[model samples]
Target: MTRMRAKPGRRTPVGRDSRDSLRRFVEMLAEKHPPLSLDAADLTIKDPEQVRRRFGRVFGYLTRVELEVERNVLELRVLMPESTETDRIFYEQVWWPQELQHGVLLDAAQQGFGMMPVPIDVARVSARIRVTGALSHLPGMLGVIRLLYYLTGAATERSAVIAYSRLLDGLRAMGEHAIAETVIAPIRRQEPGHFAYYRGSAEALVKEEGLSDWQLQLARILRRRSFAPVGVTSRRQRADFGDVARALHLDRDLPAVARQISLVEHELLWAQQLGLKVPRYIMAALDEAIALSTARSAAQSVRN
Candidate 1:
């Protein structure tokens, strides 16, 4: 575990309001939700070729949704202690199964389009994260790291909500109403609550603890470097993400999407965001991924 020497700041009390909010989220979890029957019959693509092309692109990256839960659970168990048990419970009991089911449904949909699903290797928490987790056990460090976790979660889930919204629109426009209704809508619906949880948690923590400039900078740097769309973990995932963005015509709106995702961080990190639409680092990373994907596809075509 990488032991970080964070200033020993006073512990911010996790107040009753935060606990109440978590309880509300807990009460909302349903064991079974929409898209309950995602077999081959559920796919309503009028053109299977487009389905194979477009829906396959979306489904190809759903594995990250599942693997990330594993990483979150492992990291949270280490970083979140007794006071933050509600956050941990929500992830384990509510979020994990919901996200895993998303992967399953997307896989089924992709298979219906005659696309082979990529196998997901569930990620174990790595030594570096474990070390960071251990460092988070310290008093001053724990609060800051926990705040980062919530902030990261907020940004990520907000991005997911936006992507799924765009995807739902694209599917509906293509006259795939069944998918728009059953698969995309339901999954997107659940994401807002998760985002709300993280947003509320972050707001509360930040209000209570108050961020130093150094803390804000750390948050900015971490988010700038680490933020990736769902299912983006490797070079291949980046390519897949880029392919999906292009297929869905999302390439043009990425700046807007990036801006929306960075709202909280912008407020935290910059004074009036300094006229930045989105962080340059994040935009650069996305551009690089798209270029890589294009190059890869071109190379494969030449080989064929």
Candidate 2:
């Protein structure tokens, strides 16, 4: 776990509007949007030679997406001690199952084309992260951490939406209509609601009294220091992320995606510096990881 420094602030009262918004969001999540059914009909790929080949790459990406559910269980525990149980109930019962099914569907698609699903190593929280979580049980720390989680979640889901949209388009262009509708479409539909929760929480929490300038400063530092693609701690995962980016032609669009992620944070922390731009660590990590993956593939070809 990454560590940082900041003074604790006072807890702020949640506004009626914010509270109402959360209630509505939670209710919406409780409402059923049934998970995708992965049957032979929906799983059918129209252009196996073209689309399935690319889906082999998409499988790499979806595995990471699905695995985040497991990681988020731990993340919810660490970031929001006050609401962990409530959030955990929703995640385990609802969100986790849906996203995990997305992984299952994608994995099935990959298997249809005879590709293996990428292995996921569930991340263990480091001592620093545990200490941070414990410290969050203190007065001011929880608010800041929770705010960071919302910001992170919003950005992550936004990026996923973009990636999935483009991937669906790519598949359709390759005449893989079934995959465009069946696999990617349902998966993409699920993400926006997740983004809405995070965006709404970040917006609401930032205005609360408990959040302070020092905590915001610490958040800025954490955003800069700790930001990376989901489940990308290891070199192998990073390489896989790189391969997916290239396969989806996302290398160019990534900077734009990073900016979208940074927008809410920039407004929260440095309104005057709204125009401020720093190198996006996520983009750099993907680029470097992709380079490593590419080199390894080339080396393997030579070996073969």
Candidate 3:
């Protein structure tokens, strides 16, 4: 059995509102939306050619990222050494199990279209992450890191909610309602809970002075300088995310989507600049990803 690594002095949060909110949400995880059942998928592929042509890339990308939840948990354990027991319960217990099921289900969906399982990176946690974990061990650093996690989680899930919705529509338009209802709908339903968990916790922390001036300042600087698109650690993955964004039509409303993704961060970290339309780091990452993806597609077309 793999040991669940944690730091000393880690405990549950003491406050009532945020703690209670998260605690209630965790309870709701099992009660509200138990792990998705791949066994129950209707698994009907209406048109293999159409499904492959329209959704294969998006499904493959989503499946690989979702399946990488194990790696994410490992990263979390290393990066948030000061995590409370509640945090552990949420990430390791509630979140991972559901997200893992999502991966399995999505893989099943992609395979239904005759596509092989997308490869996932579930083992390596990388040297850069370990160094960040080292920083997390410092005083007051855990809270900063945890908040960043919450903010990022909110943006990521929000993106999923939108993407899944678009996928559902496309599937329905193609008369692929069986997979849409069985796979896409259930997965999309569970996403908001994850988003709520992150958004509520981040909002509460921001509301209650859960951080200090210097810490907040440092957080702002780090966020502006170091922010990357969620789950993107490589140029290939970045381009894949851009493809997912464009496939889901997220690129059509980049400013609005960017604002929604970074809402909590804007309110919490960006100096009350209510007028801040989009965070430069996020928009820039997406733009670059889209550019790379477009160039690659153009090159492929030329070669063909």
lDDT of 1 by residue, 1-304 (tens): 2222223452212233556755665556544333244553366666768767765766676545654566667667766554466776677777777787776777666666687867665656667567767777565666667777877777788768877888889888888887678777877878877777776676666654455655656666766767766556678878887887677666787787777776665655553555776777767867877787788889999999
Residue range 8-99, candidate 2, lDDT tens digits: 45221222366665666666675856566777337676556666566576676676568657766776776566764435555666677777
Q: Estimate each model's TM-score.
A: 0.83, 0.84, 0.92
Worst 10 residues of 3 by lDDT: 1-10
Candidate 2 versus the native: TM-score?
Answer: 0.84
Candidate 3 clashes between residue pairs 3 or more apart in a chain or in different chains: none
Pick by TM-score: 2 or 3, better one = 3
lDDT of all predictions, in order shown? 0.68, 0.69, 0.81
The deviation in Å at residue 174 for candidate 1 is 2.4
Off by over 4 Å in 1: 1-16, 29-41, 79-83
Higher-lDDT candidate of 2 and 3: 3
Best model per lDDT? 3
Between the candidate structures 1 and 2, which one is better when assessed by lDDT?
A: 2
**lDDT tens string, model 3, 207-277?**
55357766777778888777777678889888888877777787888888887777767766773566666
Clashes per model (N, Cα, C within 3 A) = 2, 1, 0
Candidate 2 clash figure, as a count: 1
